[model samples]
Target: MNRTLTNTVKPDVISDFKEITKMRLAVSVVFSSVAGYFLGAEVVNFVVVLLLAIGGYLMVGASNAFNQVIERNLDAKMNRTKNRPIPAGRMSVTTATIIASLFTILGIVVLYIINPVTAMFGGISIFLYTCIYTPLKRVTPLSVFIGAFPGAIPFMLGWVAATNDFSIEPGTLFMIQFFWQFPHFWALGWWLYDDYKRGGFFMLPTGKRDKGTAIQIILYTIWTVVISLIPVFGVTGRLYLTPISGVLILILGIGMLYYAFKLYKNKDEKTAKQLMFASVSYITLLQIIYVLDKFIRIWI
Candidate 1:
């Protein structure tokens, strides 16, 4: 009986840890950082890359855990978030806070080993996400704009980790991710508008998923596509892309843009959800293309 109880409790604890850290989302963030590392490093360092992945994940996870703690009560009010570990009574606030604190410390130390600049940006990401964006979510839709700062950091953070410098290359990477977030998140905001409303969170630009929000999504999508092509013109220093890769990225951008337009035209939950998924695919593929292009260029 005691063995059975121990086994059951162990699994529940592990599951709760996953929930508190938002494991999938954290891993996705780590992917972005690793991709950036590859793009920036002329010669890849596998050890540094591994450290970046671990540090990135821990930082993102810490931010998410802290967010869950802060929003536990509000999360309980929303159907979408009601089943989260904290809201479902599977975890205590004190336990979550302790875990977040440890993650924060360890994440910073690991990133600092890469470079001071990388660690500084990582710290900034956590601070902005937890201290600023989390509270602003309930007060204004501008929170999304504020949130983009931290969200964009991971991509550039990897670049800084590889190069140990902050320059136009990383800045351009930052801009691309920064603009991409508006369309990606606004689409998500539209799809989850009703659920978000229950938590008193303002996500959409116009706060009601109307034409204004759709227009903003379209504009940002356009900006994301345009910025992504800038590296092809030999203006972004070490971040130049081959003409072939540039054209391929443009095509990918247009594919995502098509879904954004669909959301604008349809103005429904299904369309918004489609755009959200498209945006995710677009960013992921774009990173893969960038890394692949660099390797191909090196090999040839």
Candidate 2:
């Protein structure tokens, strides 16, 4: 009886935590910081990574909180997000607001200690996502475009924090992530267009499933692959591309595009889900490959 009670109660507690901090969203944000850090840091700094992990959580969590605050009603109408804390009435607006505010302020402070540049971008991402992008979602499908700015920042945020400057390296990282977002999110929009329609979100250009959006996905997927190879070409300053790594990246790009075209051809929910999953794998693997390539080059 005691063990069963603890297990049941534990889920409730975990769900509450997810609601408060938007754990799923925060995990992505921290990843950005990690990607950025690895690209910029000349030497591994555990302390910096630690601070970034926590601070990135707060910054992304704040955005997630505010997103829920604004979209609480809309979320309730969607099956995918219906159980979210705010939509489900599990957390109050007032408490969520306070928690978000505290996290934002605390998170920025932590990043500021690392450097003004990291803090500046961190602060900007929060403002853009919460203040600009969140409101824009209801008004325009272009909100996804606007949101990409903040979304792409985390992968480059570490470079600024470690180097305390904006340079081509971080720019490359930002651009890579920026292009990656369109295909990834568009796949999601395709998958969840039904739910989104109920909430008045104009996610697809056609406002219905069609080839136009799928073509855009293929274009972006192509662009994403092209950009992934730029660093290996040694053309981007502070970024170099070697032959072996180049071949590996090309193969990976093909994998992503294969699935992208599959979605484009079928335009079914299952294909869209596969493309979405493939995209996640693409980006995460790309980051890992970049780090590995760096180690190989340095070692060689």
Candidate 3:
């Protein structure tokens, strides 16, 4: 009876742990990093790619776990986050801390084996996400701006992992993702303003869900679209997009811009939600287009 009960209870623990680490979120970040790796690698090493994915997931997971630990109280106040492990009383702080520390150490070790620069960027991402962005969320709207730095790193870090260099190419990748995040997150923030306020997070630039915030989202959407096209000019070192890819990315960006404009025109929660979904689609499709273009160039 005892053995059977323990077996049944284990799955619950696993689910709670996964919740604390934000597995789906971590996986999306890993996908971006993997795309970067493929773009920068001249000859892909499957083993190194595997290490990068594992290490990236570990680092992101650790950061998320730490964030939950720090924000357990605040999380409990928010409807969306109230069910998280720490906030829901499903996991102890001590257990979460141990898991986070283990993940951090293991992640860094695996990345370091690839290259010191890769490991260094991974460590910085975790520190910024957990130590800086987590606390700053309640203090100022600029927290989202600061958070974009670490958020953008995975795209560039994967490039560094592939090339083992810090150059204009990686910087371009970083810049693209960095700009993309503003509109993406701000739109989501607009839709979830009430929930975010419950947890004392000020994610929107204007600190209110109004025309001002929507305007900023629109402007950043424009910038994101423009900057994404820069690589097609052949100015960003090794990062060059062919005109075909550029047009596809342009179409994708325009789709995001359309929704951003709708949010601007309406300033409504439903439009903001639509913009949020469009932003997600924009980035994912853009990444796919980029990888496909790279492979096309290689084949030709």
lDDT of candidates 1 onward, in order? 0.94, 0.86, 0.92
- lDDT of the structure predicted as candidate 2: 0.86
The stretch of ten residues in a row with the least summed lDDT in candidate 3 is: 16-25
Poorest stretch of ten by lDDT in candidate 2: 200-209
Q: What's the lDDT for residue 255 in model 1?
A: 92
Best by lDDT: 1
Question: What lDDT tens digits, residue by residue, belong to model 2 across residues 49-133?
Answer: 9889888998998888888888889999999889988778778888789888998999999999888888899899999999998
Q: Write the per-residue lDDT of candidate 3 for residues 1-300, one digit (tens) a residue.
A: 999999999999888878888898889899999999999999999888999999999999999999999999999999999988888888999999999999999999999998999999999999999999999999999999989999999988889999888999999889999999999899889999999999989999989988898889989999999989999999998889999899999999889999988888888899989998898888888888988999998899
Highest TM-score: which candidate? 1
TM-score of model 1 relative to the true fold?
0.98
Candidate 3 residue runs with Cα over 4 Å from true position: 1-7
True-structure lDDT of candidate 3: 0.92
Stretches off by above 4 angstroms in model 1 are: none
